[model samples]
Target: MLSGMKVGKNFWNGAEWYLTSWRSADDPSPGPYRRALDTSGLPDNIVWEGDAKTYRAGPWNGRWFSGIPEVLTYTNVMEYEMVISPRETTYSYITKPGGPLTYIVLLDTGVVRRLVWDADARAWQTYFQGPRDVCDTYRKCGAFGLCDAGAASTSFCGCLRGFSPASPAAWDSRDTSGGCRRNVKLDCGGDGATTDGFLLLRAVKLPDAHNVSVDRSTTLEECRARCLANCSCLAYAAADIRDGDVRSGCAMWTDEIVDVRYVDHGQDLYLRLAKSELPPPSSPQAFPTAPVVGGSVAVVVVIVLVLVLIVIRRRRGSTISGKLQPCLSLLSFFFFFSSFQFLRLLITAAYANIHSTLDVPGARSCALSFPCIEHQLSPAHSVTSSSAPAPIVPYVDLLTLREATGYFSESNIIGRGGFGVVYEGRIPDGRKVAVKRIIQSPLLDEGGEAFMREVEVMSKLKHGNLVQLLSYCKDGNERILVYEYMKNKSLDLYIFGEDPKLRDLLNWERRLEIIRGVAKGVAYLHGLNEEVIHRDLKPSNILLDDNWKPKIADFGTAKLFVVDQTNPTLVQTAGYTAPEYITERYLTLKCDVYSFGVMLLEIVSGRKNRNTPTLLSDAWESWNQHRITELLDSAVAQPEPELLFELDRCVQIGLLCVQQSPNDRPTICAVVTMLNNSSSQIRAPKRLVFDAMTEPRLREADHSAKEGASSTSNGSHTIYLS
Candidate 1:
């Protein structure tokens, strides 16, 4: 350990490393706040007020802690680790050798700072800090409350669903320390007959671990059953969310849950609640209850009045139709006249507006027509004029791109696909980038546009497991996308390479980390404002940074599903495509899930999911024969017990992901949650839909052409073994 480090603490020095308190400038004494490594379970950095954890740097998730996703970008500058053994467990980090001069300090106040020495300025510069905002404050919202930094309100604290502020007076006065209380109490009688369920809270930091029981052997479903059986368990979450599955077991709270808040890249927490407290399911019925009730009463009154009128008319021997005919005609005439005038007035206003615009002398060149042509002609300008795009990702001039990629030299080529060729490049600022130059063809305009749209989406997306889109160039027929270069390139070359040394690099832990990263990236894509489904999610599309951390890439073939639209096209890669997607042209988030599952199994076995005699069938057979160890990659020798358990659990999840029925498949979000929570239960998948990969027609075509299905005389579709 460096200076100022204790048996339970670690430190480093480089730049101006110092911590200041939120006190009078003259006060140099320490405050209540202290930063320390939490030794419980997987180690993480936490700032505590006495014994209570006030703020956390988040637990390590392979590459970095859950909350600090930016660490992925610093792979070239830093390395972090947590050591666990029978003797002791500790968390530590170090700057990459000869990379940067940096130091970290825990302030007397509450801030944790990482600083670097600025040689030119002869001063220390702040590199990073935790508790950077009010939302970072621990338990800013009391128990069962959520803190949203982006919420549109005067206060960030809000109660979780099925819950309300514990003290209305305190809440109103902005004193949320009382926290929140459930609206309905749990109905558990210890007989498993009670009406109780769980409420899932997404993107949240797990609550304090106090008074919580942790078990690493049960699945998530089993954990829920356990919590339900106890009757005192208030909440449950996965004990180890590293693999994103319930098989890792779980943690169940038996007392008041505290210090819970939402973070950008946080874990999921399933809070136990009474069934009655659950929010009502949503429906499409738009008619109001008040209108229905009032209409019914009016109809009844009208019926009674008509009956009396008819009786009087019959007694008088008079025709009621004749009497009402004149009145009805008068009302109809008045209504028609009003409607005619309204239509005429609307038409006149529109004509006047059009005429006025046309009268302008300069407007002849401009199309000032309805469904304005100007907006369509200058979309880039219009989009920017209305609302500025994020500056983080921008458009680059063609000249700059050409200089970066040596005018698309063959020597620079790094990756190739049907849509484009990716080349390694270095920008003017000495930062490395990958430039993808699209193949231009008049018949492939849609593909080009898709590439551009993907660039737009990728620019806005920020995640550790996603390839960052830095800029783009769309000059004339040349369309190009700039990305942050990954030194390790794609995963396929490493895992399926001829070199045994290369294959061995992906040990059990590394493979699990890759799976987790890919799951996270997929989950983020699925949860976007407009859900994006990467129809092609094969290993070649998964890239790795210098540290071998995986990043999901190649969105050129992605399908963006708007709120009301659906994907009707059949598209994917061979062996990795979902059966439902190919046969019925069925599309959903589950299609990508299936591909991810296939890739996951491949990663574990170090083999490709090829045609006919498939990896899928082989693994399934091995699983059924109770010899899954036979399917393990030979590179991983003499696996430890823990590694074997993780491998088995991952294999189970992969099978679950590749289920034949899309409905039976879990969503990508669920996959991420499952990967993190070891105790989450995974249901055994049904038998897979078998395909004949060696068919004559499939053999005639290339792998890329084998994605479609053929229609039979009976109107049913058959997979092309793609």
Candidate 2:
């Protein structure tokens, strides 16, 4: 049933007809070849074989089959009509006040029978049946071919006034599958314009209409003229099948004709033939005729593009040098595509309005990072636009992310922290990166405050040992901060791993390098006149690169050790937190120094200070006993007295920084200079009393958890102690 059609039991609606197959054998279940009123195309009843064209009732015109001298009786009992438009098509029938309801059905095979129940017979009586014999084979004669069901003992097939058998042998054997062959092939010279003509095929089931066009607006004369204008047109049918079924205009077919059947009720299919082969058209009678939305052509095109980009990213994302780059891109596309568009429009419009002296890399091209003008379309890693390194760093945008972790996708997730996750990202095309995304809330005021402080600090603080903050974003609540990715990750990877040889990655020489690098970063942070202190420093926070350079990260919990200021005290983790700060809320640069000392000890001994085992405790106790060699990492295996002295000095410094007094320990700068100068004299730290090392005193070290600090995705967050 096409779109809109009145349905009822006597009418045998689509549902009723469809369900008949489930009825019992005695119940007279209808067959599978579905029969329904095809309100579309001219409007007639058509039987279909699961989307395959089986047969059709050529539409009703005002008169008879136009070919079959019948259907004039149609008005005697009922009124039938059809309406066609670009939007939809429908065929409807209504009978007089006391008239009977009518319906059509396809039998077990392909036979079409129009049945009108007889009150006298007490059974369904067929009013009409079509294509009853072999001669009724649909479109047996093919395009321009006609069939007569009443032929005497022989298949009645003949050409419509024109056209010849496409295959002569097949025709002799009665294999009409040869269809109707053209007498002459079209000569569509180079010129697109050409002339064509049509032979009227009547009383036909029409041709295989898989490909055809219908137009009801034109007259029969106009239809002929239009057919003549196109060289490729193969056939045409009445625009409306209701009139004479003669076809008001023409349903044109430019493709091969198929599925033609002889029907008592069929329409004229005007088949195009060579001008020389067509009979003169004195009269207009032509027997015969002729995303469904979201992902339409346009939407499909975008999805295709998105898939292509994702593929490219996957390939490039897995590169060892840039693991997370591709993954980041997918993530960005999923979450930030729309946000990016808005941001892009914002930047595109703002480009000309702003002026600054800072020589940003490809400045003019830097619209929120897309940098249309300066944007370099890199085919690979090398041969980027020729330009010296620019000193200016602009605010980071989503595109900069693509250049970073390749775009922060799955392959780029270097590590998953308790809070947010860590992604290996890149900055611009050449820079490698680590992007850390925070997965917690921002209502605590810590996120924004810490972020701004980081940018302001990273903006001016430059040191080889500190992780560099490339940029930040507040897309929705999606807070992302990008930094340079360290190739070797952090110290815990090598020191805590089961592989004894893993420590080889951090040999004594590399360890010293990391120590110095960390000292330098700490020194740089403390050097700020405003004084920035890393309140939550730990070994994991210290990342190591391929060159064994140490860079400190995770500033979410860092505190500003202002020279003279006071508010929301009790900063820093208990274990690495300075004793004075933990006991008295005395935040200072010395707090970080203490944490750094603890980290240095971990690096040297391969043991966590807070979870010290008997070996560690005994080793430290033996340190003062001059048994330092016993305290060296088992992975290190062997150590010289000089290395022992170095470890001892670091341990002493760490213990000194953790002293119960705020004024005793060295500042970050002093510690850096102290650790760097080989010949410089450094005071040995005073050992604490027995009570300090007792179990009871060490049990109260859950300040961070007790204070309920909002853990960041990176396992870093500030603990507010009001």
Candidate 3:
């Protein structure tokens, strides 16, 4: 409230002293700049004119800033506390008994004042004034200094007893903040260990305290002992200095100290320094007494690593999966081998600096660097080593997975899917695995139960293209579903030019194989007895395995419909969506057929519909315009001529599935039968006709762009009738 900077009406949670004068009675644009308690030193409120520190309320005593005479009156209106000790000294105001006219705020403008509302007068009145003079510029002195603007010296800068300005030239120029430096560097915790000491400064502000460890129950002596023992522990203090006595609590610091100032009342801070960094001692000093210390440095590090590894290893194995370790391990091996091969080529004979030259025995050959996380997690089984094709999610005991992943860490995230993310984890025996995370995001579903549908549906169905659900966590708001990590991730990478080799790897044979796998998966979803329609299907949803097999994943939005039963409204996606569903809201197995047909064409063409001139138009042009080759992804070569025939057949099926009239499309059974047929030449589909009753302008506007831009559209429907 005191800074005079306004927070907006909407975001403000009404703390009156700031911006608002109690309520919104005043113009809140901007008030004069003013600042309050800076705890970097003995706590006090100081008003300023930009560069000049104008007012001083003095340092905080255990009860109040000693210089604030108004605080004595402050007791009449409200009981406020001004505290000082070691960890920090602070100044704050709160209401007390019978104290309705309360508010001690730093006023806007360069004035330091306390305000009290006169309820009867219906106005606020200021009772306290600060910055009586120009002597309050903090750190007015240069490095190694103290500021007493009232000083009689010709030069304002004064070096402390033993320290000097870091740059005497700069000191003359009045450059501070780069205060002082010890002429002799301290022999810090380098080498073995060294002696150090603390010099006490009385009634002064403590330096910045960041690495503080506080203990309320500990006494002053106990606090000192704690700091002396650890090489890193620098200072200690009793947080609250009260009634002219130190009270409970301790705070310790470990780094360089900066910015100390004092008021009429302030804290006593004990600082740490190496013996060399300290002043010449008046009396011989004993190494400050330390608490009992145990264990070698290495031993402690190893013990800590052991405990951390135990916890993290388990979680990593379970959540993100330890694929990172395996991945790194794999990379490390390649680097190692590549280096060795280069060395063998470069050196006369097998090199002699084997051990000394960063090379180890048997490491030069094709030896595993670090065992893959899979080997570490489970020695008996590869995370992906199911005798039968691995389930989308393997059925493993919870304990086993827990033992594998070191409990998911930042390093575990490998990939993500619509339903969840994939994490690399490791198992106990050191096997690495990937874990899929079904995240809970507000944008996808608001209520917790909406995600439960996926569990219910996936629990009963299994198919190759369908990503298998490994396990689910329903214990809390966590509606997490785990699945087998598909090593190659999704087909998007291969199809999208994100990875060039990806396309080449999936040659004609593999591409056709992926098509069939997907067809079968979507076919299963549309079967008679257990009809499941995948409402969302795309390249991102299709995951590829280590062997490049495509698996349809993320059935969270999938709908299970039965034969003869149909949805009355929109369910499937557009483009891939059956025309009947988008235009008139009628859904059938043909809906999934339509979607599957889109996916089939996508796999063969290695192109996305959203990126095309138009999926249907592209298909039509490819069929008749001699640009058939352009339809296939440029990254991948043409599939076998026989396979090209299958691609053509599938493309035709896709068109039939997307016909404007649902009745015009063949049943899924007939389509699959034709797909399964080895000798049958699928019948060509009739070009769909648009309704003519609609006004030409509306029809043209409503018509998809892909249809308009690629061709003139002046001729009759170009049907390839058989």
Task: Choose the strongest candidate by TM-score.
Answer: 1
**Cα lDDT tens digits for candidate 2, 1-722:** 22124322222233422212213334565545665545433344555666755555454343332222333454566654443333333344556556656675445555554556556434444444443334434455666555543221134566555567777788888766666766677645555455455554444555644436666568877767666676667667665544432546566677776655444345556666656665443222322111112213334555566666568766776454255556556655754555455455445434422321011111222222221111232111111122652243356766666556655678888866433678876554766767777666433244465555545555444556677766676554556677777888977788767788887667765676677668767765665455666777887788887777788887533333222346445344445666555445666677687677667777777776667734234534555444556666778757543344456555555555544455666776666544543222344444443122442353355455445554642011111111
CA shift at 266, candidate 3, in angstroms?
99
- Candidate 1 lDDT, tens digit per residue, 1-722? 23223324322321212233444334667667666656564345678777777777665433455555445555676666555444444555666667657677666556566666656545454445566444566777788776654332245578876789999999999788789998888897746677777766645567766436866667888888888888888888776654534335677888787666555445667777777765333210111234334445555555565556566667766557688556556555644555555555555544543343232112211222221122212212121232667554677999998889898899999999655799999999999999988776543354455556656666666667778788888787777778889988999987788898888887777787788778877776776656667778988889999888898887643443222135455445677777765654567789889999989889988888774346776776666433679998887775654356456657767877887678878887667654543323344454455433432234345333544433321011111111
Strongest candidate by lDDT: 1
lDDT of 3 at 222: 81
TM-score for candidate 3, please give it.
Answer: 0.37
When 2 and 3 are scored with TM-score, the better candidate is: 2
- TM-scores of all predicted structures: 0.45, 0.39, 0.37
Q: What is the lDDT of candidate 2?
A: 0.53
Better of 1 and 3 by TM-score: 1
